[model samples]
Target chain A: MSKPVSKFYLGVDIGSLTTKVVMVDEESRIIARATGRTGFSGREVASRLAASLLIELQLSEKDVAATVATGYGRVTFPADREMSEITCQARGIYQLFNKAETVIDIGGQDSKVIKVLPGGKVSDFTMNDKCAAGTGRFLEVMAGALEVDVKELGGLAEEASDSCSISSICTVFAESEVISHIAAGRTKPDIVAGVCNSVAARVAALTARTGLAPDVVFTGGVARNKGVVNALAAQLGTRLLIPDEPEITAALGAALFARDIAPKNKPCV
Target chain B: MAEQRRYRPLASTRQLEKTMTRYYALTRYHRLWGRPLRRPLAWVTSGAPVELLLAFNIHPVYPENYGAICGTRKVSAKLCKVAEAAGYSQDLCSYARSHIGSIMRPDLAPMGGLPRPDLLVACNNICGTVLKWYEALARIFNVPLLVLDTPYLPGEVTGHAVGYVHEQLKEMAADLEKITGRRFDARGLEKRLLLSKETISLWREIREFCRAEPSPLNAPDLFIHMAPIVVLRGTKQSLKYYRQLRDEVKHRVDQGLGAVENEKIRLVWDNIAIWYRLFAFFKDFSQRGACFVTDTYSGGWAVELSPGDPLESLASTYTEIFLNRSLEFRARQMIDLIKDFNAHGFVMHSNRSCKPYSLVQEVIRRQVMRETGVPGLMVEADMADSRVFANEPVKNRVQAFIETLEA
Candidate 1:
C-alpha cells in the first residue's frame, strides 16, 4: 500500500448522519474507503477520516492530487471542489452498475429519486419535501417508539407474516400511529413491516414522479435495511439493485469527480 | 467565489429607482393630493382591469406589488407572522398574508404600509386567493369589494367567456362610476388602452433583446423593472419607463454585453421570482455563467392588448393571463420561452404560496422537457416566504442541474 504514488484523488461525503471518505488512484479505481459518524462537526470528522485513511496508506497530504466534497455539510469541508450529492450518487451508482438508469436514495434527512444518464450524469431527479417521513430519520423515530433498535427493525419486518398499515406521512404523526398499533396489541414485527412499507410507499411515489426506468438502483444509509428494500421493490414492481456499500456511493462519486479534475491540476509535489 | 465575474449592472436601474419611488411617493401622499383633487384610491389585484379604473380617474394601488416590496426588504417574515398570529393559515398566499399583516401593524411595514383605500378591486384571473384576500381588505378598510370572476379557461378564450367577462367589465365601469363619482369615459379608456399597448410592446421588445447571444438582462433586471408595468400600466409614466429601459437594454445588446458575465447558460425561469433572495439566488447561477435570460412571471404583464374594443381588449387580456391558462398552454408557453430565448434549460419555482402557478409545474416541466429536448429543474421554495425554503437542498438541485447541462 505504501507505493509512494505521485497522485491520489479523495472524495468526501459529509452527510447529515455520517461522513464517508474514499481514496482513488490515478486509474479512477477506489484504493481505500472510510466511514464514521459526522457528529456535531462534519468538517472535523471528514478531515479526521480522510487524514487517517491517508496515514494508513502511508501517504501524506502532498500525494493527494485533488479532492471533492459532497452532501449537506459539503461546503464546510476543505476540498478542491464541492458538488451536489445527486450527481455524486448517480455517478457512484453508474460506476457500480452501468445498467442503472434510475436511482432511489433515502438519506437521513431527505429522500430522492434520480434518473441517471450514461457516465453517471443526472438526467433528472426529485427529492422529498421538507419532511422526514420518507427518510432514515423516520425509521429511527419509529424504531424508538417500538422500543426496538433501528438496525434490528429490518430483521423484525423480514420475519413478519402480516403487516399493519401506517397511513400518516408526518414523522411525528406516523410515530404516534406506530404507538397506537403497539397499544392495540399489533405484533412488533408486523408494525415494523408497516413502517417499512410506509417509507417504501413514500419513495415509490417520488420514483414515479421522476418516471422510473428499468435497472433501478437503491442507495443511501437506509438501503442497508433489507425490509425497506423488499417493500420498495414490491411497491415498484421491479427488481432493485443494491450496491455492496450503499452509504459510500456518494463519496465514491465525489472521488470520480475528483478524478475528473485531477489530471489538469496535478500537484508539483 | 472565484475571480469575481458577475452580472453587468444596467444604468437604467437608477432611473428605474427614481421612477418607482416617485410612484410610491405619489401613492403614499395620495391621501393629501387625491382627497383634495377628488381622485379616489382603489386597492387592486395585479390582474384587475386597470385601464377601466384609469378611465374613472381612480388611483390604483397593488397589494401584490407591495407584498413584493415587503419580500424584497426581507420584512415579509415579520409581516407574515402578524397575519399568522391573527389566524391566517401558512398555506395562504404569502403576499396576501404579508399585505394583511402590514395593515395590522403598519409600524413594522415598509413605508408604513399602503394608504387606506376607498374601494377594493379583485380579479380571479391570476388566482382564487385574490378574491378572499380582497374580501379581507374590504372588511378591514370598510370599503366596497368589486370582483371580476374570470371563469377558468380550460381551452382558448371563448366567445361566451369573453362576453361574460366583457359584461363584468362594463358592470365594473358602472361600479367605478359610483365609487369615483366620474361618468364612464370611453375616450379615456381608449387612450389608456393605446398607452398600455405601446408600453407592453416596449416591454416585449426589451425581453426580445435577450434573444441575443449573451442576454443583456437577467431575471432580476426584469423583476425590478416590471413594477411600473404592473401597477402603473395604461399610464404615460409606465410607457416612458419602458422606453428608457428598452433603450438601455438595447444598448447592451448593441455593445455585446451580458447580464451574467460570459453567459454560458441562458435559462428561462418559470413562476414568480424568489423576491427575498432574488439577487442572491440568481447570483448563484450568475457566478457560474448561467443567466436567466427571461421568465414567465415578468412576461405575464407583457401580453399584447387585443386590437378591438377597449372593454373587450381589457376582458380578453386580463382573463387570458398565463396563470389562467391550461397546463398544455402553459407548457407551450414554457417551450416557446426556452426556444425563443435560446435557453439551455428552464427552472420552475415550486412556489408554496402561488398554487395556480406552481401546482402543475411538474407536469409542465416534463412536457416542456420532452418537447424541447432540454433539461428542466423544479426548485421548491415560496416566492415570498423564506420559512418554506431549504437552502442546502435547493443548492443541491440547482448545482446538479447546471452540472447536467454542462455534461
Candidate 2:
C-alpha cells in the first residue's frame, strides 16, 4: 500500500507594504514560505506568492487543506478563514517560544504591544495611536535622510561611539530634525543611533501602557534592525526572543490556525 | 474609496432637526421676541441645572450640543486649530476648543455661533474642564458665570456634598432673581423639577427599550434623540419627543427589527461617540453583525432623580453621574450595563479629547472583563477629530475582537 500523502495548510499575511505566505504540514512545521511587496494590489500579490510557493514546494492547489489570511490587507485576500494580526502574532510567538508573555510588534506603519496569556490567547494589547513615529516607516524615512540602506542602519548605529538625541515626537518634525543634524555635520552613525533610540522609546511607552511582562518576543519587519533591537532591549531592560524569520511569524501563526481548522477538525467560527 | 452609502436614518431625526432649527432660530432672533416674551438666553453646560433656568423663564442653550453640531458638520478640526492658534493647548478638550474657536470667529462658525448668552452656567459634575471652559467663555463674553461645583464622589453621595451643592443652587437662584428682576418662586421651581423628572423617566424608558432582542435603537439613534433631553429637559417638548421615540422603539421591538441587519453580537459602548465618523464607523461593526445597543455617554442623563427636596435631589442626581464617580463605580456601572443589556462584549473608545473619561479606562476594562468574563476592545481615537483616527489599526483590533467573541 502507498504511504499517505502529507496534508499542507497555507497562511497568508497581506500587510500594507508586504505580503507573506507560509505553508505548514499537518504537524505544524513550516515546509515552504514566500514574501513579496504588496504594492496597491494585495490580492494580486498574495495570489502570485501563493502560486510561487506551491511551485517551490512541488504541490498543486488542491494539495493545500486550508488557508487563512491575516494582517491589514487580510480582507482583500480570499482565504478559507481570516484572522487579525494581533491574534496571529500572539499565536505565532507563543508557538515558537511557548512562554511568550509580551509581544512588541513594530510593523511598517504601526506598532502594537500584546500581552499573551497561557494557551496563546491575547489577554490585553495596545497599539500606537494614529501616528507612524515608532514604526518601520520611521526607520525607512530616517535611512533615506541619512543616505543609507535601511538594513545598514543597525550596523552603522552599532559603530557609533555616541548617539544624538531626537527630541521631536512626530515623524514629520523628526525628519526635519534629522535634516538639521545632517546639516550641522553630525555623524551619520550617531544620527542613525538616535533614530533607533527614538523608535525604541516610543515602542517602550506603548508596551508600558499594556503592562509589559517578561519573556518578550519581538516580531515584524522592524525586528530585523539590530540597532532597534539593541535600543529596545536597553529601553525595556530585557532580552527579546526574535524568531528566525520575524516577518513570517504572523503568517506561520495563521498556518497553524489553518492546520487546526482543516476539514477533519471542528471549524473555527 | 468605495461609494459611501448613507444608512437608514432615524425617523425622529427629521423632527429633531426641525425642533433644533426652530430653537436655534429663536435664539438667533431672540432680540425680536425677548423683550415681549420676557425670556433670557443662558449658556448652560450639559450637566447644569437646566430645570432651574427653565423655571426662571430663561432660554437654555447648550454649547456642548452645538459642539456636537460642529463635529457632525466636520468643521471641528478647523475650529480646534483656530483655538490652538489663540493659545489654547491642543491637549485641551476638543469640544471646548472648537466652541471657543467658534466664538472667536463667528463668521466661520455655524449659524454665526450660538447667540450671545446673558449668563453662563458651569457645572463640574461632568468634568472640571467645564469649569475652565465656561470661565474662558465668561471672560470673552463678559457674562456672569455661575459655577455649581459637584465634588467627585469616591463612593455614594454624601450629605455634605449635597449640602454644598444645595447652597450653590440657592445662591444661583438668588443670582437668577437679580438678573431677571423677579422673586424666586418655589412653586415654579417645583413644577419645573417635576417636569424634568418626567422627561428623564421618558428618556430612561427609551434607552431601556434597547434591551430588547435585536435592539430597537443603535448608539447614534440614542445620541440623536437625546438632544432634546439635554436642551429641553424641563419642557413639554422634550417629554413629547421622548414619548414618540419610545413608541417607535417599542414598535421596532414588536416587529423584531434590529438596529443592525443581523445583530449577532450586542456591544455596550464606553466613552463618547466619534461624531465625525458616527455612521461610517458603526457601519463596519454592523456589517459584521455587531450592534452597539447602548452607550455610557448619552445614558448619562437617564438616571432616576433622587426623592428629596427639589434642589437636594438635583444636587444628588447631577453629581452622581457616571463621569463624576471613581473608576470602581464606573466599572461596576459598565458591568451592570453589560449584564442588563445582555451584551456579548463591549467597546471602549480611548478618546484623546476627554481625559477624565478616557483615563483609567484600561483599569476599568480589566475590572469589567474580570467580572463579566466577556472580552473588551479599546479603540484609541478622538471623539471630534478625525485626524486622530487610524483606520487600519482600529479595523484590525475590532475584527480580532469580534473573532475572539465568535470563537
Candidate 3:
C-alpha cells in the first residue's frame, strides 16, 4: 500500500530585489522555505524555487493544495490567488503577535505603514513608493558610495561616536551629500549612522500620517538592519517586535491564506 | 498569457468628438467670424458667471478647459517648464502654469494656443489661485480684468455674502458693457439665466441616471461630457448636446448595461482627475469589475439654480460651490453621494495642483468612512503633471483596497 500523502500550501513572493517561497502544512506550520535573487525574471526564479522545495520534501506537484502569490511582482507569478503585500504582511504579523496594532514594512523599493485592526485585517495603510529615499535601495546606494557592504552598515553605525545629518530626502541628492561628507574627511561610520537616522525620520513621518499604535511590528528586508531598526524605534518612541526571518513574513502570510482561506479544488500552477 | 481586458467605448463618443472639434474650431477661427458677428472674446474661469458675459454679446473662452486639453495631449509638462522658466513658481496651480506657458509660447501650444481675449474675467469662488492666475493673464494680454469677489461660505450662505456678490455683479455688468461696447439688457440676462438653468437641470438628470443598478455612466463619462455644460452654458447648443447624451445614457440604463463590464463594486471619486492617465487608470479598476459611478469634481455643475431673482440666484448658486464650502459640508456632500449612488467605497485623489480641494481631504476621508462604514483610499498625484504619478504604488493600494472590499 502507498504511504498516505500529506497536503501542503505553497506561497511565492516576488519582490523587486528577491523572491521568497514558503510551504505550510494543513495546520499552518512552516514545512520548508527557499529564497533567491529576483533578477529580471521573477517568474522563472519563483517557479524554479517552488519546484525545488517540492522535490526536497519528497512530494509531487499534486501534493500542493493551493498556491498564492504576493508582492510587487505578484501578478507575474501564476498562482491560484494573488494578494497585495499589505494584506499579506498584516495577516502574517497578526498570526505571530496577536497584539500587534501597527506594522511598518520597509521593502526594497517602497516603504509602508499598515494599521492592523482586530481580526487580522488592514484598517488603513500609507506607502512611500513614489521615490526610493527611505527604502532599502536608498541604503544600498549610500553603502556603495562609502565603499562598504550593506551588511556591515548596522555594526559600523553602532561603533560610531557621533552621527552626521543628511538633509536631503532624495536618493540622488543624498548620494552627493554623502560624497561631499567623504571629501570633507567625515568617517564612514558616522555617515552610515546618519543615513540610517534619515531613513528612520522619513519613515516616522509616514507612520504619523497613519496614526501609529502600540505593539508595532517591523518586517521586510530593511528590518534586518539593526541600525535602522534602532533608529526607527527611537524616532517613533516605541519598541518594535522583529519577527524571525523578517523577509519571509509576507510569503508565509500568503501560505497561511492558502491554508485557511483558499477553497479545496482551487486550480493553481 | 493572461487574457487582456477591454472597455466598451460609449456610443456618444463620436458625437462628443465632433461637437468639441467644431467648438474649438469656432473658438480658434473666431477672428474670421467673431468680428463680423461683433462678439468680443473674453477669457473666463470655470466658475465665472459666463451667462452674464453671453448676455453682453461676448464670446466666452475657458483657459482651464484648454489646460485640460494640454494635459490630455501630454504637453503640460513642457508648457509648465516654459512658465517656470519665466519666473512663475513651480508650486503654482499647474493649470495656471500650463496656460501661462502656452501664452508665452503659442508655437508649442495645442492648436496654436487659445485665441487672444479682449477681456479677462475671474471669480474667487473656486479658489484664490484664479485671482492671481487671471492677474498674470491680464498683464500678459494687456486687457481689462473683471474680478468677482464671492466670499467663501464657511457654513450656510449668509445674506451679507449674497449682498457682496450682488454688488460685484452690478459693477461687473458695467465693466462688461464698456469692454464689449454693448448694453447689459436685463431681459437678455434673464433669457441666458433660463438657458443656463435648463442645461444644468439636464446635467443633473444625466448624473442621476447613474443611480440605477449597474450604472449607465462612469466618472470619465461625466468628466468628458461636462465640457459643453462648462463652456457653452447659456447657449442652445449646450442644451442640445446634453439632450442627446441624456437619452443615450437612459437607454444604457434601460438595457442594464454597466459602464464597467461585469460590474461588481461601485465607487465614488473625489478631487480632480489625473488627466494624463485618465483612461488607463480607470481601466485598472474596470478590469477588476469596479466602476467609479460618480465623482464630486464633475458634479460641481449639477447644482440647481436657486429660486430668486436671476442675479441673486447666480450669487447663491455660484458662491455655495462644493469647493467653496466648509469641510463639514463637503463631508456631508460625499456621504450623500455615496448613499445616493449605492457605492461600496470611495477614492480620493490627493491632487498636488489644487490646494483648497486637496487639503483637509484626510480629515474628510476619515469622517466619510466613519459615517458610511465603507473604506476610502487616497492616492497622491498631480492632476495635470504626470511626473508625480507613481504607478506601482497606486496600483498596489488600489488592488489592496479592492481586496479588502472583496473579503
Candidate 4:
C-alpha cells in the first residue's frame, strides 16, 4: 500500500487587538491554531507564530505550499495571498455550518455581524468600529470589575437567578454601573449575566437592523462565553451555532481560500 | 418679491460683524435647535422632489441651513434636547442632533411647516453617517432615494473620473427629467453655469476681502452667507445676492472694520465647520478677538476650471475634496490654508462622527504646526450629533487655547 500524499497550508489573521494563526492539511482539517496579543511589531509576531506552529507540528516550512493572510493587518503580513477578513470570515462560517444564514463575529476590540446568502455571498453586514462598547474588551473590563477570571465568568453568569439591567451604552459608564450594582448588593452571577446581556443587546440591535436570519453562528473570541451566547440566541429568537473553536474561523477560511488559489497541490483536492 | 424681501442682504460689514458677535455671545455652545422630524415630517422630507420642494415657493429647509439659523439665532440647545431624550449619547455629532431636533419639533418652524424637502439626497461623499440618517428617514417616510456612488476616486481626479462623474451627472439629470417631466435643456444648463460662475466670482471676492488686516466679516456672518451658495446654487438670484454681499464686505474692508467687535489675533479653522456648534465655535474664537481668517471650506472654491469645463471641474472637485483625497493631499491643503491666512494658530475639531475627515487630523495637525509655526489644537466633538457636545470642557479648552495663542 502506498502512503497518501501530505501537504500543509498556513493562514494568518492580524487583527487590531490579536494576531491569530492557523494551519490546515489538504482536506481543510485544522492541524494547529495559535493566538497572541498584537504587539507593536505585527510582522515579527506573524513570523514567530509561523515558526512556533511549524515546530510544534513537526512540519518543515517547505511542506507549506501556500500561505494566506486576512484581517485589518492582512496586507501588513508577509504572505503569498492577502484577503479581507470579511471574505475570509464569511467563507469560514459557510464551510463549518453550511446552513448558517448569519455570522456574528465579536473580536477583542470590535464587533461585526455578516449576513450570508444561500450561495455563500455576503448579502449585508454591520460593523461597530466607532465605539468599544459592544466588544470583547467590554467583557474583559466587566470581568475585572467583578473580580472574576474572564474564562470562568461565562459559567458563573449562566448560574445567575436575576440579572441586573445595565442602562449605560458607553463602556466607561457601563463599568461604573456594574460597580454600583455590586455596591447595591447584586449577586456576582447576576451582574456577570447583566454584562453579558448588555453586550448581547447592543449586538442584537446592530444585527436586527440588517434583519437576522436563522442557523446563526457566533464566531470570534466573545462567542466562547455561554452567557453571551444564551442572551444573543434569546434576543435573536434562534439557536446560536458555535464551532468548537470559534476564533480560528477567519484563519481557517484564509487557508481554505489559499488552497482554492493554489490548485496544483492536489493533496487537499 | 415678498419672499425676496425676507432675504434681505447683510447691509454692512459692521452690521454683519455686530450681529455675528451678538449671536455668538448669546448662543453659548453648540446644541440641538429643533425637534426630530416625526413620521409626517419624514413624509414631507422624503416625499417630493427636493428641487421642486425648494421651489415650493416656501423657504427650503436644510438641517445644515437650520444649523446656520440656530447659530445666527443663538439658540441651539433647545433643539439638541430632542436628540438627548432619545438616548443619543453626547459623543454623537451635534449637527445630527440639531437636524433630529428640527424633525421632532413641529413648533420650531412657525412659517407653516419649514419648507420641507419633497425629496432628500444623502450621499456618502462627506460622511457615511448621512447614508444611515437618510435610511432612517426612508423607513419613516417611505420616500424614493437616489444614491450617487462616487467611489473613493483612488488618486487625484483624472480624465477617467471626470468621465465617470459626468456620466453620473447625466444619469441624474435624466432621472430629474423623468420625475419633473421636463427635459434638461442645454441652454438652461449654460445659463445656470454662467450664473453659478458669476456667483462664485463674487463669493471669491468676499473671501479675498478677509485678507485685510482686520477682516470685514466674522465667521458667524460668513456662516449666514453660506445659505445662498448651498440653497440657491446655479441661479441668477444667487449671483446677484453674492455681488451685494461682496460689495458690503469690500466696503467694510475699505473702512478698516475688524471681523470681531475688537481687533485681536487671527486664527485658522481646520476641519469642516461644526454646523450645530457654529455659533459657539465662532463666539469662542471671536470673543477673544481671534478672527477665523481662513478655513478649509473656503479653499474648495479656488478649483474653478471654467464654465464650459464645469462638468469636468465639478467632477474633479468631488474627487479631489479633502474628505475624499489621500492623507497627503489633506496635509498639504492644511499647510496651504495656514500659510495663505498667515494665521497665528489653528483649531482642529477632532470630530468623532466623521472618520473620513477626522482619521488623519492628528497627523496633519502635528506636521503643519511643526512646519508653519502655527500651533494646532484638536477640540473633540460631533459635527451633527448634539449628544457629544460637552460645553464645559469645550469652553475651558477654548479659554486655555486663546491664552496659548496670545502667548
As for TM-score, the candidate ahead, 1 or 4, is 1
Task: Evaluate all candidate structures by whole-model CA lDDT and list the values in order.
Answer: 0.91, 0.87, 0.89, 0.68
* Lowest summed lDDT window (length 10), candidate 1 chain A: A260-269
lDDT of 3 by residue, B217-243 (tens): 878888888888988989988888899
The sequence of per-residue lDDT tens digits that candidate 1 reaches over residues B208-327 is 999998999989999999999998999999899988999898898999988888889989999898999998898889988999999999999889987678898888888898899999
Per-residue lDDT of candidate 2, residues A126-208 (tens digit): 78877889999889998998889999998998988889999998999999999999999999999999999999999998887
Q: Which regions in candidate 4 have their CA more than 4 angstroms from the true location?
A: A1-269, B1-61, B70-97, B108-113, B274-284, B298-313, B383-387
- TM-score per prediction, in order, is 0.98, 0.89, 0.93, 0.52
Per-prediction TM-score of chain B? 0.98, 0.96, 0.98, 0.76
List of clashing residue pairs for candidate 2: none
Write one digit per residue (lDDT tens) for candidate 2, span B1-407. 99544344568777788877878888899888876887888999999988788889999899888888888888888899899999999999888988999998888888988888988999998888998999899999888999999999999889999999999999999999998877888788889888888988888888888999889888878877888888888888878777877788788888988877778899999998899988878887887888889999998988888878888888888888888899889999999999999999999999999988999998899889889988898999888877788777888888878777765
DockQ numbers for every candidate? 0.77, 0.49, 0.54, 0.01
Best by TM-score: 1
Model 2 chain B, poorest ten-residue lDDT window?
A: B3-12
Instruction: Estimate how well candidate 3 is docked, as a DockQ score.
Output: 0.54
CAPRI-style class, candidate 3: medium
Give model 2's TM-score versus the native structure: 0.89
List the candidate numbers ranked by DockQ, top first.
1, 3, 2, 4
